[model samples]
Target: MINVNQITHHFVLGKKGNKTIVPVLKNISFQVNQGEIVTIVGRSGSGKSTLLNLISGFIHPTEGEIIIQDKKVSEFNETEFADFRLQHMGFIFQNFQLIPSMTAFQNIELPLILKGMSENARRKTTADMLKKVGLEDFGEHYPSELSGGQQQRVSIARALVLEPPLILADEPTGSLDSETEQDLLQFIRELNRDLGVTFLIITHDDEVARIGDRTIALADGKIVESGVFA
Candidate 1:
């Protein structure tokens, strides 16, 4: 479903005035199959999130190519990249970046809404997703009115409502209590099971990585270990 080949990334590290081009990732390569959950586990500054961004087309790598469905995304122009992402990708941020002004249903519907899906289709899609994520009754509430876990569920609902082939979640359970985190993690697993949504989740928690069909551990930006752990 996704291919990353010979990817290397560098960034200016340290204070703005003293930034230096420090190599972070060195020729990393990996693949994610359809309907599988792959977890990236690493310490802080390990470039786990950077790998996700490279695949998402947020930033270009100095040396590598990313292919999705046999098309090289790294070669797309900015306009094409934007359109491709809207059509093929769905992202969940650790911060639950919801629009505070929009109701839960509105936030979940925003993507399809922008994609020109009809109102009836959007309604059916959004309602089904919310129900799947156990947020069917909270559609009219705002983000601020929802608890952290509830808000994250809303985020997940929005991310999946598009029926994107891949879902990239970065530190999805970083903010919740243990029970809530467990619940959210299990919910993610369910999505992978029921919907066959391929997932590449970035997380530091052991429980999070344990849920994956495979786990890859990063150390200083290198994938030191990768194998089937579950």
Candidate 2:
């Protein structure tokens, strides 16, 4: 599970070494439970993405802390954070950050390979993940050859291959057509249903948020509303 408490982020902007703080997040607090799907929904520049960054520890909060399991991320060393991310966090970025030259299977296996998994283990895991995501036949295809939706499935497989406890998806279906979006959404639904992969998704679409167990609404760097759907 993930917990955020009174978190805040600010960016300094100025000229000639003089910087003024432009606050990006303010007192954001929430917790996501294991096996739940939580959505942070808001329009562009509403601080949704900033909040995601704060949780990921890519940017430290000016105030407050994020706790994953029982450890405060703010206190973790760089090495420790790296290991934690590799072991427990799966990120599906708004932009599919796939390498153009790597095949779908290769991209999905990168994390395991980095952890020193044996070649046979890597191959087996990759194949199983592709099958899990319904990408078994596209394993040899590169990102450039896949459709937006197919690429997203590949990303999802990559994220799930580690069987990480938490998954962070930022605008995951943002670029796809409605049908493809539906397909991707269904896949995530099944993952949550069958694998118990906890997810914190940032999105602007109401349809996507509708599927979440709870909604956290953000505006101008603060959470204005949060509630579970009936």
Q: What's each prediction's TM-score?
A: 0.94, 0.96
Candidate 1: tens digits of C-alpha lDDT, residues 1-230? 88889999998778878888988888899999999899999999999999888888898988989998788999998889888888888888899999999999999999998899999999999999899889999999999999999999999888888889889989999988899999998888887898888999999988899999999888888999999755
Give the Cα lDDT of each candidate: 0.90, 0.89
Error of 1 at 103 (Å): 1.0
Per-residue alpha-carbon lDDT of candidate 2 for residues 156-229, written as tens digits (9 for 90 to 100): 88888889989999999888889988988898898899989999999998888988999999999888899974
Off by over 4 Å in 1: 13-19
- Candidate 1 lDDT: 0.90
Native RMSD of candidate 1 (Å): 1.9
